[model samples]
Target: MSAAPHIPVLLRPLLTACAPVRGTWVDGTFGAGGYARGLIEAGAAKVIGIDRDPLAHRMAEEWLPGFHGTIVLREGTFSELDRIAADAGAEQVAGVVLDLGISSMQIDIAERGFSFQKDAPLDMRMSQSGESARDIVNGADEGTLADILYLYGEERASRRIARAIVAARPVDTTLALAEIVARCLPRQKPGEKHPATRTFQALRIAVNDEYGELAQGLEAAERALAPGGLLAVVSFHSVEDRMVKRFLQLRAGRMGQGSRYAPLAEAEAPAFEAVTKKAIEPDAEELASNPRARSAKLRVARRTAAPAGRVSEQEIGMPILNTSRTTGGGRPRR
Candidate 1:
């Protein structure tokens, strides 16, 4: 039997890229404890699992004991992973692994509101308690809603979808909002994702502050890692992949030599070195077993003795919402 209820997106390649995993490691997005368990089984002496969702911790109670003392669960966002690990007595860790975005388990649950296919409350709160997708869909102004869809989800019909949603105020449930957004776009064709996919994804990302969390979480991992420690991330979308790529590039002192569009900056000691020169994708065999891995991308880096530093959100290609047009549901994490 598998240790995790569902296999994570890119376990094989992630493990391969982060080979010889040992010592203490932080599974920053410990959804369902899959990656945490994977790290322990991959030769880590201990794994500190961090998650924002209560559901993940609740489900972990069943199997965590089986691992004896190998897995330690901490309930919090990955953005605070470094502090959380230090509090747990691990000042620095051997590796940090993050499986970004909503887990498959969250989407499978009908009431989580992560899945547009499910007719449930529009509550895409990873922590299960906060301003939910319901609040954003119903409360955010049309322009704010449009910006979220456009910037976060890359939805070209964001304006039309936002207008339709405002016309259908109090979008009470997942399906209700999905239906409204779908009406503003072309009907789905064979093999194409549902029309509401982008809109729902946009709102969920907004509700969860996923991009901000990701940007902060990467830095946290850098700070929490000891010299030679590994940082591996699996991202499911283009925007996320781009962010990770840029962060690693900038940190590893591989920022392209003066691209005409990019501003030059003084170089400092590199904090990390790339372990995987290119992003790894699932093989055909794994894709056959888990179709969800089709879009997954894995990147790995190793920490250096150099001090960890910051990267501008712009440097990493994080989508910045126009503050003037922004309103509820997408507030930056405090």
Candidate 2:
């Protein structure tokens, strides 16, 4: 089997925050089985690993058998944790870790079409079971496509990039998209980042519905955790990190608004206590060793006895973008 691609970002902090001794733990993303393997190695009684990617499921099945703890790998999104936990007979998970965004394996594999650097097909679905990137770029309206790039990638030149993309209709390849995007930006300096990077990121996030999944997954994690349970997440971009930060702040009653003298109406007991006031970034050593670790930010929170809102597994299936799937070289209505 191929070696696991993920480096398991924020391992020490995640384990420390979760602190699983003998209870059940969940690795929601289970990319490369890194977090699951780490939790098991750290002495959890049982570890349940879940991923939407069928490839990840197969990899875990092949690799996690001889791990120290009892390992159970399931195939599904983290937003469906309730079903995963129920099926595994785990009453309450003591710890849950979600390493958000695509794993290194996906980016490194050129055929997955996750990176702008490599020439590959334009297919970026994480589950490998949905509409491909080709379906979106080649089908979606220019405005809808531009909005996705701006919101997901935080790219300032989104309109120009989207215009270029639309002008080049029936763009069926990764390099084709990347080259078009590159044309919209200034010529790169020797050490400057690739202009197509953000555009590719935007496409990947839209293709995978990653941020949407994260929101649902975070809410699900809160619901699935027992009192005093932990939820740990590592995000590689600002959009995700902001969500994690805001969610924790809102849950912990840490949002700075009114004064203590003002009597505030009692809300549901805060569901989480933020373990890291600010998200943690990798150290110099880690950053130097793995450049992919550069953008990663880890946020962790412990569950309170307080009630949390419910999130359904079906919610993840909702359409986030207005794009249509077209097959005959015609634009699909937004």
Candidate 3:
């Protein structure tokens, strides 16, 4: 029954884009219930809130009741949102809203180990179970660690960072790992991001299998949404934004034709029509109010009458990692 700590990033524009919101909607991420409350207050008949993190559900206990049953909180990941919605008695949802990446609530808590600023156990599991950052840093091979940093974080000195991490085995704390990474790189210039930022981001993404989850969740959203239902996603980084953008482009038949020599294959009917041709960033006012809103981008699209169909992970530009060994704890065999 308390107010959300802060307004969700790009929520105003998301609601504006998906105006006249009605029927059952699914808040896929459901972190802190900001979007769910916004939808309910904006006119959604009901909202099925889903999250993998138990903390998110526990936090909701205080304020969810204030919605008077308008929002139904579910314990699960958005990758299985379709099943989650069905179990909640919503066969088809009118809209699906996903706020990707770690939430402010998760980052602010030192024990969560998401922030390098606060030293804590190197645990960054979103679901609070499975492999942790500690396991990855202490176990994964050098090459695999390098790939994760390069592909996920776009870090230019991934090899050097990975080498440093491997040499400094048993890195048990956030600050320890951050210091190791910072030592490998040059001192940051004024206004430059911390050296450990990319390394931490890469480790967190790997620990949570965030890219894999995003690909599956996008496909699940396609299936769960009713015809004309809207699918809106807010991504904080380029990797996530690219995946969402390409998925919409391919689904909406916006992909361009191939060159004369190499003909493009025909695609199925458009599954969705873009509501925002380009990603929508927060306005200056929002940025001033919430500095975290700076990098966030919101993209929305409306489902077509076409039947729900699956899109290949490659088609959506999903970042594929060698998850067989490196992701779990062991080195891949030659």
CA lDDT, every model vs. true structure? 0.87, 0.77, 0.89
What residue pairs clash in candidate 1, if any at all?
none
Error of 2 at 96 (Å): 0.6
**Worst ten in a row by lDDT for model 2:** 325-334
Please, what are the lDDT tens digits per residue for candidate 2 over residues 96-189?
8889888988777788888776688899888887788898898888887787778667789999988999999999999999899888999999
Tens-digit per-residue lDDT, 15-132, candidate 3 = 9999999999999999899999999889999999999898888888988888889999999889899999999999999999999998988888888889898789999988899889
TM for every model, in the order presented, reads 0.95, 0.88, 0.95
Please report how far candidate 1 places residue 329 from its true position, in Å.
3.6
Local accuracy of candidate 1 as per-residue lDDT tens digits, 1-334: 1222578888978888888878999998888887888888889999999998888888889899999989999989998999999999999999999999888888888888888776999898989887888887777788989999999999999999899999889788988988887788878799999998888888888888888888999999999999999999999999999999999999998886456788765778899999998999999999999988899999999999999899888889999876455555455533
Residue-pair clashes per candidate = 0, 0, 2
Q: How far off is model 1, as Cα RMSD?
A: 2.6
Which pairs, if any, clash in model 2?
Answer: none
* RMSD of each predicted structure: 2.6, 4.7, 2.8
- Specify the highest-lDDT model's number: 3
